[model samples]
Target chain A: MADEQTTLPPDDPVRFYQVGSFAVGNRLQPLDLRTVQAAQDRPNALTCGHRACQGCGEALGARYALDAAVRATDGRLVSVNATGCLEVFSTPFPETSWRIAWLHSLFGNAPAVATGMAAGLRALGKSDVRVVAQGGDGGTVDIGFGCLSGMFERNDDVLYICYDNEAYMNTGVQRSGATPPAARTQTTQAVGPEPGNVFGQGKDVPRIAMAHEIPYVATATVADLHDLEGKVNTAMGIRGARYLHILVPCPLGWGSASKDTIAVARAATQCGLFPVFEARDGEVVASTPIRRLTPVDDYLRMQKRFAHLFAPARRDDVIDRLQAMADRNIRRYGLLEEAAR
Target chain B: MPVQIEGSQAVARAVAACRPGVICAYPISPQTHIVEGLSALVKSGELPGCEFVNVESEFAAMSTAIGASAVGARAYTATASQGLLFMVEAVYNASGLGLPIVMTVANRAIGAPINIWNDHSDTMSQRDSGWLQLYAETNQEAADLHVQAFRIAEQISLPVMVCMDGFILTHAMEVVEVPTPEQVARFLPPFHPRQVVDPDDPVSIGAMVGPEAFTEVRYLAHHRQMEALEVIPRVADEFREVFGRDSGGLVRPYRCDDAETVVIALGSVLGTLKDVVDERRARGERIGVLGITSFRPFPRDQVRDVLWNASRFISLEKAFSVGIGGIVSSQVRASLIGHPITNSTVVAGLGGRPITKASLHAMLDRSARDELEYLEFLDLDRALVQREIARTRVGTRSGPAAENMLRDLGAVRSTPH
Candidate 1:
């Protein structure tokens, strides 16, 4: 698995400037072509030495987004964080893991707080100081949804980023508003008849965010650093109520290998389970074509949260149901380049 | 100049005078009129440079205040009853982060039975929210307190809640000396927050506090609130000097000296209590009244000092701690430690129940004779409660007690659900 390349066709046109043909970094790329991450002073926004699990997708996702945001704003981004795994793990008393200006308010009020910060800056005539508010799936999709929606509806000048890890990862992997169907969370256990999470529930925040008719709404994953950074930069480029949702895989919550976070995230997007695209004013402007589509198990089989469906008689019915979801997303977003194929 | 205006209008005017930068408002009744007036002022270009945000909910209202205040914009908002409860988390956040946000709480009863009138339950529920609480004795005081709330909150970098009785104060027009903008400007200078969300100096304003610093941070907030005990009186005195009125203070003791019976209370109920006390004074009964201006810093020592010589004191309050008796009474008891004065608690005006002058007269006369119970509810229908108690004992299931009471009183026009 370690030696394998991405499960995409060679002619997919998704080029990677790899390090030693294995690692992702700036080794031979030209200065401007390279990501801000490859720069000498790339604003190590969530700096090193703080506590984040090994191969944490959220950590990578935040690093990409904030660096791009910091670059876009020219070091004038005051980030308001919602209390979750990212805030808890990155910062602990008297010590912080953030390089840029950051604030960690309560879980559900990040958007409103960011709104306030934007209003504050507006009032204080500090328009240069752009506001970026970030939170986990629980914070963004569930608890903080009202504030987020208010921020969107008000068209507040904020780039709200939701690091979607599917469940309440920090608080023992509880089911959240963004938890995928047929997934086992602490709250939605595997012992139930229908087991895991129910299908008809959970919010499609990217779509809901689009419904707000906000200036910008986009979805990205840590597996695609360039896409993630590109979306963040695009969001920062806009002025009012922008949202960038990143599906960052949690090894701890998902019960997957710490080293396999990026792989899992990549599989989720590639499997068409999590659509990667951008939208403006409630209309879909672009969808990242699925270079290669795989069964939902290609993503779920790696995570232990979905291990129940695999072992003790495979739940093919559930798997087919999930695969149908992926297919629906594929068809809806036109994720496959069928004509090109 | 003095003008007759509703408490809400007065507050709106005072808030305008304070020159609030961001006003995130949601219309909850009684609290509605204040924002209405402010919105009108903003629309008419009278309140310029203010961002009149029409938020969807009370939570957003407070969150907007938190955001606006965090960025060094003077923020203001208003709520009452369940609206206050809805934004309880943001209420704590505003004070916890030490954002100098000034909010007007048209104090209303929180509900299970759906009350929309005056009570202290709203603010009482937020007693430990790390905010400075001020209750107004009159519509005039309610209006004037906003001017002082901004100054005090900014000075300490903590949020302030100026509470006035919902509907009663908010609706009732009174002769209030609405201070001119110049006078308000002289009293409350531009908000100079101690800390702000500045990109130039990027300090993480609200960091995740772990075991190590969480206690110290909380203690620091507690210490700041203690400092408010001193700052409250000074701010009120300074307010009086500038505004030409003795309105805002920790406690306003009227004829308490050489008194045998003193009555202490919060909000506009004190005016009625004061009238009763003055009547008793004319009858040569040693009685007085003390209005608690600042409820949260409790004003314990001032209350203790002023009521020192009284033979007995009664805490007539709008809300109680349910099974624990009086909310303010419990604090009053904790404050009057060394004194051996006989004290009683009059838990009145709950769930929008009115506290009338006749009832206060009877309650005060009972307290004068030391015949008042340790805890009493003013104008309570004991017959209804007793009937319910007896019905429960005898196995009568008439649904819930409130419904049963309504049925017992012949007020129910429809079938019990």
Candidate 2:
């Protein structure tokens, strides 16, 4: 990581981006594509003064996407939230930070609830209002996955956005189906010979969503605010069940510096570890290209949960396997927006 | 106008006329015909303006309904027995979130020795859920209750579970007053969810409540359910005023005044028991019948008043409380703890076994003879129990696991069918 060095620029674009412009915060993008950040207008659709934890990536991602969605729809969007950290932290009975019409559903059934909401709105001749159903990875990839698949299969008129932080953060960091490989979670300990999580396991929901062929399926990262906002805005344009799974790194669960939220998230995409791409009907149609590919170690080294792999002298094999995974993702999705070889 | 129809068909027709925004369902034995009829209606465009989500499991069914409801729609769903238990979590949330979704539960027994018959076990399991619960005594009541559920649920911003006896109400066809779409549209206004997901007023729902506010939130649910009693009567009065019928709102009494003997029950059992009561009346017996149509509200005060003068009370239930007595029978007994009435619990007609008229008359005869037995396993034969014991040791020293192992090894003697 960055070892408490004061050699950083006087005005860190990352800090400014949260308050100023979404595009202003990046240290890796070219000057031409460097656009203003999402919070320049301080929409704060999630607002402030809720119970979200420090450096909560879900909190950040939700606020950024929702405010952008509201802006895009021009106040014609309604959010159906599933029971999870985002729902719990934002609403505290009789009080809410949300400024939009919101409906809360069960932990494992947000997709179904959102489908109902959309149907309800349509019944009332209010099809102009778009529906957004949201939940954490635990709710999305694990508990509510079946219901989510049904929504997609039926092509329900709703945009389901999964703020995936890998684990069940609200319930004390247990292992979720979306929990990354070799992650030190409470359930998946770092004790086995292969260490944390065994490879070749866990549900790859994006590919599953693609199989449904429900018009649209996209994956984004919180590191790229524009990409996330763009995907949400695009999903809203579609009439059927649209899925957006965003990788939001949790500071508490990942054991990373609170400030490294965007930085770590950026490294994940840049290293080709978490491919950012959009697919339609099971085929990859578009992707956010990685201009400069970084080493997987750069991303893994920043998080203390992955510190075990680097601590025991050196784990060349483990690191190599991680790199291989990144390579496979890069080749599979063609995430690099740059020209192909 | 009122027309004779089966309870299941009445529910199906009412749902079709109401034109729900979405219908999610999963089949469970006795409750299968309700959804099956609904599916037919949806497929034939008889029930237009709805999406019939045929889910893989009951959990998915309820979950889908929850999603549809949250989107600000009039969602309708149904389930029974294992299906009800499977979707219990979503069922609780559908109520707690105050989504005015209506669900019809066909009461049936849960299984281990796997039986698929009618019972109150399933509904009793969900008694504490915040959904406004109402039981139907006849096909007409079952049909009328669906209309009332939509009205009551929409008014209170709560989910309502309209329970009907499995097989009895579900299979039997009778005359039911079917309201026209225009009349129903007027009686039950289209659902305008109090809490909606609007972009202009962005907010979160189903938020976690810590120790600070969990109790108060649950208390609010409690207060609303209690208030359902007030809303129920008004809706029923409205139904009566429009359709000129009072079959399915709350408890209905039959010859329960100044009587020495009273029989209390719910669902179609009342119809049969009423027949036997008439038979007994012709023979100069001082017996009366009190059919409890609303089980969730329990109707404790009304129950006491109905049976207060009776010397001996008999409770017949298709479902029983395993370790105790009849579930409803026990509840009725508990309500009369301070009052008079020698109440005896008799369980009958479990797992789809037909509750015959002769059996009903026999149970009454037994109660009259002071031969009232507690925890009477309805339709349970000793030969079957012996056969089961010979095949599997459930309550034995070997335990179920050992019996299973023995069966796997072919060591246990197989019984003849």
Query: DockQ of all candidates, in order?
Result: 0.63, 0.53
> What 10-residue stretch in candidate 2 chain A is worst by lDDT?
A30-39
Candidate with maximal TM-score: 1
The TM-scores of all predictions, comma-separated, are 0.95, 0.89
Per residue, candidate 1 scores C-alpha lDDT tens digits across A33-134 of 468887787888888887888878899999889999999889988988999989988878578888888887788999988888888787677888999999
- Ten consecutive residues with minimal summed lDDT in candidate 1 chain B? B408-417
Q: Which candidate ranks first by DockQ, i.e. highest? A: 1
The lDDT for every candidate, in the order shown, is 0.86, 0.79
The residue ranges of model 1 lying beyond 4 angstroms of the native Cα positions read: A1-31, A338-341, B412-417
Cα misplacement distance, residue B206 of candidate 1 (Å): 2.2
Show the lowest summed lDDT stretch of 10 residues, model 2 chain B. B408-417
For all candidates in order, state the fraction of native interface contacts they contain: 0.67, 0.77
Interface RMSD of each: 1.3, 2.4
Give per-residue CA lDDT, model 1, range B1-417, as digits (tens).
Answer: 789888889889989998999998899977999999999999999977788888878998898888888778999999999999999988898888899999999998888877777888999999999999999888888888898898889998899999999988999989999867899988888888888777777777676766767888899998898899989889878987887788787888989998888888888888888888888889999888888888888888898899878878888888888787888877887888977888888889886676888888887767766689988989888998999988889766656877788878987433321
Candidate 1's displacement at residue B178, Å, is 1.2
